[model samples]
Target: MGRRKPNETMRLLVATFIGIVLGFFLGVSFPTLSLTKLNLPSSLFPSIDLTYIEDKYSGLSTQALLNAWSSLQGKDGSAAEINEFNESRIWVPTNPRGAERLPPGIIASESDFYLRRLWGSPDEDLKMRPKYLVTFTVGYEQRKNIDAAIKKFSEDFTIVLFHYDGRTTEWDEYEWSKNAIHISAPKQTKWWYAKRFLHPDIVAAYDYIFIWDEDLGVEHFNAEKYLRLVKKHGLEISQPGLEPNNGLTWQMTKRREDSEVHKDTEEKPGWCSDPHLPPCAGFVEIMAPVFSRNAWRCVWHMIQNDLVHGWGLDFALRRCVEPAHEKIGVVDAQWIVHQSVPSLGNQVRPKALIALGLSFIDMVFTSLSFKSCQGKAESGKAPWEGVRERCRKEWRMFQERMSSAERAYYVSLGIDPPNSTTAR
Candidate 1:
C-alpha cells in the first residue's frame, strides 16, 4: 500500500489523541457514568471491555468512590473471603449480664417450648437441625450470667462463649469448654471491635450466624422455626428483633427524585399515597440481625469504613444491604428489648453539627454538578438528555434535604439555624 499523505497521517494522529483525552477526562470527571455509555471501539480498546471496565474502576481511589472492597482488602487478614459451614443452624446467646436483664420466665418459656420444638423436629426435606449456639460476653459483670445460660442450654445445643476485653487476665477460664472461643476486643472503636472480634474465622464455625445484642430475651422464640423460615425464604440477611410500626418508617424520602422513583418500583412496592407517609418495612435497627454465613461475609468486607466510631453502622448497612439487593426482615414474632437506649448526650450536638455540615457539602456538590450538566444539555452543548435529567433531579433533592437537615440539627443542638449567608 502506498504511504498515507502527510496531512492524512496528521489528521489520524490528532483524532486518536483527542479520543484518548476525552476518554480520560470523562472517566475522571463523571466517575459514576455507566461504562456501557463509553462505547469504546473494540479494536482500539481491545484489552479493556468497557462494560467490565466499570467494575475494575467503579470505586477508583483517586475518584473518591470509596471502594469498600479495597478498604477491606487493605486491612491485615481482612480480604473478602467466603467460608461455608456444613451445619445449617447456629445458636447465639447474648452476653450473660445482658441476658440476666431478660425476664427469667420469658427465657425459660422459650427454652422449654420454642427452642425444643424447633431443634427436635427434624425437617424431612432438609434433614438437618440447628446444632450450635454461640454467645458473646463483653464486660466482666455479664460473664457469669452468660456462662450459666450457656451451661443450661448445653444439653440441647453446643454452647460457645466469645469473650473480649483487653483488661481480662483470665484467658484460661474458657479452656475447659470445647465449645467456647475466646477473643479480645483491642482498645478500639466499637466498629473495629465488632469487625475484629466477629472475624470470619468465628463466623465460619456455623452456617447461620446469629448476632444477638445481649439484652434480647427469647419469649415464644422458636430457633428451629426461625431457621426454617430463614431457609424457606432463602434469606441472606435477616433480622428478627424489632419490627417497625409501619412501612413508611423505612421509606428513604430524601433520596434523589430518580432514586425515589426507582425505590418506589424496585426497593419498595408502593407509591406515596399520602404526602405524609410512613415507611413500608422500615430500616432495620441492627440490634439483632441474623446473617446467613454469606450475608455476614459480604457485610464483613464493608466494615472498614472511615467512620471509626459506631456512627457509621447505618451508613454501612445502607451501602452493603441495599447494594446486595437483600431485604432485612424485621421479625414481629419475637421482640428483643434494647437495654442500652440510645441518647443524644454531650457529644451529640457536635456530631449533629458535623453530620449537617457534611450533608450541606454533599448537597452543594450534587447541585452544582447537576445544574451545570443540565444547563449544558439544554443549551445544546450535550446530547444526553437522560443523564442530564437524572443529575438535575438528584442534585435538587440533595440541596433541599441538606438545607433541612442542617436546620434540624442546629435546632436540636440549641444553636441558631444557619442563614443563607452562613450556608454560603
Candidate 2:
C-alpha cells in the first residue's frame, strides 16, 4: 500500500506541473483574453472580488467611521459601543443621516428657566428673563433683613439665597421665595456657595450679579436706579455705597451725600500707595459687591474655593475690570447700610461653645488656625474669636497664593514681575 501511495503522489505532482505549464502558455498567448472575460463555467474558477474593498475604502464606510469614533471615545469596538457613543454625544454631530439639529451656539452657553416648563407655549414660556441676579448668603436668623432686601429689588431681578443654616422651607412663607432659588449647606459661607452654585455658566443669563451678605439694610437702595447709574458710569464692578456713618471701611466705598456716584476718595495716610489703586479709588468691599456679567465671568474664575471667608477678595476686585479706578466705584445715589450684624462668625454649635480652660498664650497659639479650638480648653478665647483668627489666616494665605501665582506666571513667561527683586 505504501509503494502505491508514493507512486500516486508522483503522478499527481507531474499532472499539476503539466497543468501549470499549459496555463502559463495560454496566459502568454492571450494576456487580454482572461478567465473573467471568457464565457467559462460559473464554478470552474471563482472570480476575485475587489468591489467590496473598493466600495468600503472609497471615502469612509459607516462601520469603519463608527469603529474609529468608538476607539477615540475609549470604547470597545462593537455595535453596542457605537450605539452608546451616539447616545452619549446626542447634542453633537456624528452622522449626516442621523445627526442632531442644534440650537444657536449662544443659547447653548446662556441658560434660564425655559427648560423647567411643565406645559406652556415654548415661545411664550418666558415673557422676560430677569436682567439681574441677586444672591444672598444667609441663615434663617437674618430672614427679616433678607426679606427687607428682597423688597428693594424689582421683578426684573432674580433672587437666589444660599442658606448657611440649612433652613430653606421657612423662607418660602414669602410669596417671592417660591420663585427664588434656594441652596442650603450648613455653616457654609457665600463664597463657598458661589464657587459651587453661582458658576459663570450657570448664571450667564443675567446681565449683572449681586453677591451680598445677609446683614445689609437695602432701605434706600433701588435696583433699577442702581443699574441705571451703573450703566451711566460704566461701572463693571461696584457696590451700593456704604452709609458713611455705618459699617463703612474704605473711604472709596463710603457714600457721598452730594454726589450721584463717587470713584475716588482720600483714604487715611499711607493706606493707599497709588491714588488710582484700591482703598483710595478702585475698591468695593466683599460685603455687598455687584459685578457686571463680563466682570463676574472674570471674578468667578478668580475665587479660590478654599478661601471661604473671602477676606482678601475685596482687594483683588480690581483684577476683574480694566482701568479699575474708572470702572470700579460706589453708587452713592443707591446705597445700603451694612447692618454689621454678626451672622457667620457666631454660627458655632452649642457643644462647640463650651469654654476651653487654656491660658492666654495657649489661646493665642490656637487662634492661628480654624480647627484649633475644636476640643482644646483655650481660656478667654470665644468660638467667634477662633473664627476671626481663621479669617486672618485665610487672608494671609490668600495674599501668599496670589503673590506666588503671579511670580510663577511671570517666570513661565521668562520675565520677572514689576517691582520684583528678581527683575533687578
Candidate 3:
C-alpha cells in the first residue's frame, strides 16, 4: 500500500475518532446499539447489561435477550430460552463461595440438601402421606421407653429419633431401630434437632406433631385416637393426660375420667397467679406435648439454643396460640405414664463429668431436670428438697438466658425489647 499525505492521514484519524465518540453516545442513549447486547451467546461479554437494552427488555434476562436475538436471525427461540434458563439455575457453591447469591439462614442449609441425598428416598408408601410426625430426643439408656413410645404410633406416622449422648450407632444393633430415621449429634438436645430439622413449615404435610420424651409409658396412649381427640377438641398444643400415679407428675397433667380434653387444672395454693393460665391453663409439659403444624412454627422460634432443656417453654407455649385457656389442653382419655427413670442423666463420660463440675448424681439430676427429661424424670430425687433447690437454681439461670436472647432477637428485628410488648 502507498503511504498517504500527512495531512490526509491526520484528517482520516480525526474523522475515525469522531465516529467512535458518536457511536459511544448512541450506545448510551439506546439499549441495542452494540453487538455485545446482541445474542450474548458466546459468554465472552457476560458482563454486558441486557436489561438496559430497551423498555421491553428491561426485565428480560441476558438469556431472554439471546432468545430475541436468535429469533430475529431465524434461529430456534426455544433452544436459546432453554440455555438461558439453565444458566440461571441456582446451585450450592462450596468453592467459589461468594460467586452466587446464597440462600438465607431461614432457608434450609446447603448441607441439608446433600445430607438428604445420602438418605435415599423416604419410604415410598409414606412419601407424602405421613399422617403424623413424631420426634423423640433420646439416649441409649432409655431404649425400653423409646421402644414403647414408638409402638404407640401406627406405621402411617413418620418416626424420627434424635439420639444424644454420642451413642449414634448403638441403636443400629437392634432390628426395629433401623425403621425410624435416626439423627445423632452428641449432646444436642431434642429442641436442637427440632430447630434444625423439624421446622414447622417442613412438616406442614403432617396432621400433627408428637414431640415426646423417650421415657413415656404409652400403655394407655393411643396415637391415632389421641389425634382424633385433638381434632375434635381443636387442641393445638397439648399432651396426653399423665397417669396420676406417675411419680413426679404435675397435678394439672393428671388424667380425669369425665372429659375427653381439659385445659386447666387446679394448682397448689399460691403456685399459680391465674386460674386460666398454664399449669392452671393452656399448659402441657414439654416432655409429652403435641403440636399442630401451624402452632409449631411459632413455638419453634421460641425455643432457645442455649436453653435446650426447654425449661420455661411450657409456660410460653400459650404464646403460640390464642385463648391459652382454650386452644391448648390435655387429652384425658388418652394418657401416658411419665416413667421417671433417667438413664441419660447417669450415662455421661468421665471427661464430660469432670469438666461440668457435676457429680454423677448431680449430672443425673441436671440432665433430667435441665434438658435431661422431657416429660418427667424417671424418678424423683430422694429428699425432694435437694431436687427442688437444683431446679430453682437452673430455672433462674434459664430465665435470665431466655430474657437476654429475647432482647437480642428483638433488637435484630429493629425493635426495642424493653419498649416492645410483643414476643419475637
Candidate 4:
C-alpha cells in the first residue's frame, strides 16, 4: 500500500478520534446498549460494559454524568460537589489555648480526626471505592512525574504523595485542587512508606493498591480497563504491560496491543527456566505493580527495612500467592511506558570525576572521586560495573538474611530448618 497524503492522513486521524468521543457519549446516553453486543477489540469498546468503569472513574453514574450534562444548561443551579470530604469537615482555631471561644464542652485542638492518619485510615465511608489508591514516592526534585500522576489521577482516585526530600514549601505551585494527601519525610523508599503508612488492612476499603514508581507514561493506559482485566483474570498482583521501546527489561512486560491481557509470553532462554517462574510466571517488576487488597497484605510484610532498592522482591512474590503462575500476571489490554527515569536512588553520589559537570562552587571534585576513579582505572571496569556488582551482592545478602531468620526460628523450636542445599 502507498502512503496517504499528509492532509488526508491528518483528516483520517481526526475523524477516528471524533468517532471514539462519539462512542463514549453514545454508551452513556443509550441505556439500552447491551453488553452482549459490544464485542469489540480490547482497545475498542472494552469498557462498553459498566463493571470496569464502576471500579475506577469514582463510579460516576450515568445519571450523574447526565446530570452534569443537564446542569451545563444552567438548570440545576447547584454547584457540583468537589473534594467532598474536605468540604464536609470543620476547621478549628489554630491557637487552641489562646482562642477566646470554645464550643460547649469540646476539647481545644481536638475538633478533627488527623493524627490517626499515620495508622492508615480506611476509605470505606466514602460510599464508593477507588479501584486503586495510587501512591507516588517523590523527592520533589523533578516536577514532571509527580505532575503527570496528579493530573491523571486527581479527579478519580485517592492520591498519596510521599515526599522524600521533605520540601513541603515547593508543593504549593502545583495545583492539586485539594484532592491529594501530602506527607513529607526526610528520606525513605516507596517500600518503606508502604510498610509503615499504607497498611493493607487500613487500605482494604479500596479494591486495589497501586504501589508505583513516580516516572511513567500513562498515554495508553486505561485505569478502569486495567482493573477489570486484573479482576476478571484473578490476578492478585499485576502491572500494566509496558511498551517495548520504553527501555523495558523483560519480554513478559512488553505490551501486545492485540491481546486483551496476557499472563505469560515467550522469553529468551536463561531469563528464568522454571516456566513456572518469571519472566513467565505470576510475577511483574516492582517498577509499577498493582496489588489486590489481599495480596498487598502479604507483600507488605515481605518488605525488608534495609533492602531499600527491593532488588529481590520480584522473584519471591510467588510466596505470597499460591499457584503463583495463575494469580500473578501482567495486563496487556491497556499499557503504560516506563520513563525509566532514575528518580529514586544515587541522585547526588559521584562515581567518577571525568563525568562531572561544572559546579557552582567553580570546581570539579576530583579528590572526592579519587577512590572510585582509581579503582575503575586499575580494574578496567565501567562505573556501571560497580552498580551491578552491588546489586548482586545485595540480592545475595537479602536471600541469606531471609533464610537465616527462618533457620533461627526452627532452631528455637528444637528442629532443623528446611534443607538449605535443596533451595537456597
Candidate 5:
C-alpha cells in the first residue's frame, strides 16, 4: 500500500516508453508476425494477430472464404454460396458503385446479326431486331427442301444454317441463303450444332427458337401462323405435327385432322408410365421442335455436351416447362412431312463398302454415287442400319446418365431416390 519514491516512478515511466517504441519497430519489420504461429500460451499473453484468419485467406473473396470455412466445418457450402439475385456478389475494384462489376457497355446484352455501318450511330444500325430464330442442320443435298422451309418463315425470323456437307457457297444460289448465317462442320448432327451455336444467352432476345432438320417438308406450314397459334395456347414447347402417314414414331406428334393442337394421345399400352408423360403427352420430336425463350434456357442446360443424337431428349423436354401436358404439344393445324432423308445417317460407311476392299478414294466416290441414288443400303444392312443402331445405344446411355445424375443429387441431400416404378 506504500507509494513509490520519485526514482522508482521515473524508472517505471522510462521502461513503458522503451516498450512502446520497440513494439512499433517490430510491427514495421515483420507485418505477418503472429503470436499464434509462435506457440505462445494464450493465457499468459494477449493475442496480438487479430487478423490471423483474414490473412490466411487474403486472396479469397468474402463469399468464397465463407464457403470454404463452411465446407471445413461439415456445413452445406450452398448455404454460403452466392445467391443469384445478390448484387453485392459482384466485385469491381474500380467501380464507383460498390460491387458492380459489369460496365454499362459490358452489361447483359442480347446478340444479333444486324450488320452495323461504320459511319452510322449504333442506335440507327438496326431498324428492328428479329423476334424469332430459325436454325436448320442441313446438307447441300437437301438445299431445295431447306429453301422451301426457309420460305415458310417471314422476315421477322433470323435464319441460321448449320451445314454438315462443308458446302456454303453453293447455297448462295438461293437468294435468302445470302442473308442467312451459315456455319459449316462436316458430318455433325443437329443437336451437336445446336449445343455449340444456339447458347441460351446468345439467342435470349428471340421469343422462339426453331431447331429443325433439313429433311422436313414445310409445304403446309406457315411460321407466323404457327407462332400465333402457339402463343394462343400458352405452349412453351411445341412442334408442327408430323403428317400422320410419314415417318411418324409417336402418336402424340402425329397430325390430328380433328384438332388444331393436341397435347395428349393414347399411345401403345406400356410406352408411357403416365398419360401426362412423353409418347402420350408433353412430347415433340427433335426433328422439328420449337421452344420459347424460357423453355429453351432450361433445355439448353439439359442437353448433354456429348450426346449429339438427342435420342432421349424428347421425353426430358417436359422437365423444362410446368404442367408438361399443358405447355407442351403438337400444332396439328401446321403440319410438316418428315422426309426421313437420312442424309447424316448416310455418313456411316457400310460393312459392305468396307468388305469391297476398295481404295479410300474409290469408296468415297462409290458412297457419293449411292447417296445420289436414294442412299439406301442393300437389304437394310448397311448405312442407315449403323446409324439406327448407334441411336438406340445413345438412348440407353442418356437414360442411364440422367438416372445416375438424379440419384447423385438426391444422395447429396441425404435422401433416397424414388423407385423407378414409383418415380413417374
Candidate 6:
C-alpha cells in the first residue's frame, strides 16, 4: 500500500477524535431510552407506581444514570431504605445517592418499606397509630413470667397473648391494659402450631407482630426503639433478644460440613472485631423475634409444612429467611433474658428419645423421596444418600464432641464419670 499524504492522515485522525467526543456526549445524554411499567403477576406482588423515575433521571447524563442505577441496586442504606419504602407505596423522589430521578419505578430516599407496609396507609391522626400484636405459645406454668414481661413492656407496645389451649377463661382472670388482646389456641395440635393458629387475627389487627417463647424476660428491652428501627430499616424479621453466642447445633452430614465450616469461618472477625458476628452463626434462639406484616405472611406460609413440628421451628425459619433473601436482623442494642430450657432428649427423657429416633428416620425417608433426586438412582447415585452418609459422619463427630464436653462439665460439677452403658 502507498503511504498516505501527511495532510490526509492528519484530517482522518482529527475526524476520529471528533467522532469519539460526540459518542461520549451522546452516551451520557441518553443512557436509558424508555421507561416501561411491568404488570407483575398477582401471585408475585402488587403493582408498584413508577412515580420516582422522572426525578431520578431529571438532570443525570447517560453515564451518571448508569452509575447511579448500579449503585442503587446494592445493599447500602439508601438502596435498602428506598426499596423498603417502595414496597409500602411511599415514593422517594431521588435514588439512594440523592441523584434526581433518571428512571421510573425508583423509590424515595430515607423511606422505610417495613413501616410503610405495616401502617398500610398514612394517617393524619396521631392517636390512630398502628398497633403491635405479640403472640406466643405458653403452658399454664409460664404464665407469671409472660405476665411480668408484658406488664413491663405494656407502655411501649400493645400486647396480644395466645394460649396454646384455646381457652379464654384463664386469660380473662387477669385484668390487663385495654391495649392487650388475649386469645386462646386450639387444645391439642401439632408442636409447630403457634403462628398458624394465631396469625390471621394478629395480622389483621396489628401493624406488626412479635412471636416469642413464654419463658422470656425483658430487663433492658426497648420496644419503641426496636419498632422504630424496624420501621426505618424496613426489615422483615427482626430478632431483638437473640443471644450473641447461642444457636442450635445441627447434626452435620458430609455435604453440610463444608457449608457449616464456611459459615463458621465467616464468623471470625479480623484483628479488629466486626460486630456482625460475635461468636455465633444460625440465629437468636427463636425465643423472640419481631416480624413485620410482610415477614409474618411469608413465614406463616412457610411454617405450614406438615413435616415441621415443635422441634424444627428454627430449621423452618432458616429456609424462609435464606431462600427469600430477606434480612433477619438481630438487634444487640437491647437485651432480653431467656430461661434456658432442656434439650429435646432431656426434656422428655426416654419418650423424647423414641420421638427423636422416629423423626430422624422420617427425615431420612423424606430426603430419599424428594423430587430433586428422582432420576439420580439411574446414575448409581441417590441425591439424599449423600446427606444420609454425611449425617452418619456428623453423628459420630457429635458423639465424640459431646462426650468430651459432657465429661468436662461433669468433672466441674463434682460428679464421677458414670459406668452406665448408656452414659456415653
lDDT of 3 by residue, 214-331 (tens): 7788888889899899999999999898888663436778899999998888877866677877578878887887998789879988776655566667777887998878999999
Under the 3 Å rule for N, CA and C atoms, how many clashes does model 3 have?
9
Cα deviation at 296, candidate 1, in Å, is 1.5
All candidates: TM-score: 0.38, 0.69, 0.61, 0.57, 0.70, 0.41
Candidate 5, 1-424: lDDT as tens digits? 9999999999999999999999767655654444345676666746555455434334455455445455556535463343432444445545443324556556544566555778867788777788999999778878888888899999999999988778999999999987799999877777888898898878988999999877788889999999999999999999998887776666788898988898999976777888887778888878789999999999999888877787778878988999999999999999999775646545544335678776653443343222222233557576554444556566778888888888888999999997442122
For candidate 6, the 10 contiguous residues with the lowest summed lDDT are 252-261
Error of 2 at 348 (Å): 13
The per-model lDDT (C-alpha) reads: 0.43, 0.73, 0.69, 0.65, 0.76, 0.47
Instruction: Give per-model CA RMSD.
Output: 23.1, 14.7, 11.0, 29.1, 11.3, 19.3
Give, for candidate 4, the lowest lDDT window spanning 10 residues.
365-374
Better of 1 and 3 by TM-score: 3
The TM-score between candidate 6 and the true structure equals 0.41
C-alpha positional error of residue 397 in candidate 6 after TM-score superposition, expressed in Å: 23
Model 6 has an lDDT value of 0.47
Where does model 1 exceed 4 Å of error? 1-137, 144-164, 167-178, 186-190, 197-202, 219-222, 243-282, 305-308, 315-326, 341-424
To one decimal, what is the Cα RMSD in angstroms of model 3 from the true structure? 11.0
Shift in Å, residue 76, candidate 4: 74
Residue-wise C-alpha lDDT for candidate 6, range 35-127, written one tens digit per residue:
434544555644644444544444555765466566567557475675654454433454455542334454432211112224544563245
Ranking by TM-score: 5, 2, 3, 4, 6, 1
Segments of candidate 6 deviating more than 4 angstroms: 1-130, 155-158, 165-167, 177-179, 185-195, 198-205, 232-234, 243-284, 305-313, 316-326, 341-424
- Quality of model 1 by C-alpha lDDT: 0.43
Q: What's the lDDT of the predicted structure labeled candidate 5?
A: 0.76
Q: Write the per-residue lDDT of candidate 4 for residues 1-424, one digit (tens) a residue.
A: 9989999999999999999999888877764543435655666754465544333343355676666566466444445443442244334334343341344346433221122233445653344435458888776665666686656563457778777778766777877724567777765667767777887656776678888777778877767767878889999989988989864667888888888777777777666666777667767887789888788888888888766656667777777888888998888877887765544433333323236553422121222211111122227754434444545555677778777887998999999687542111
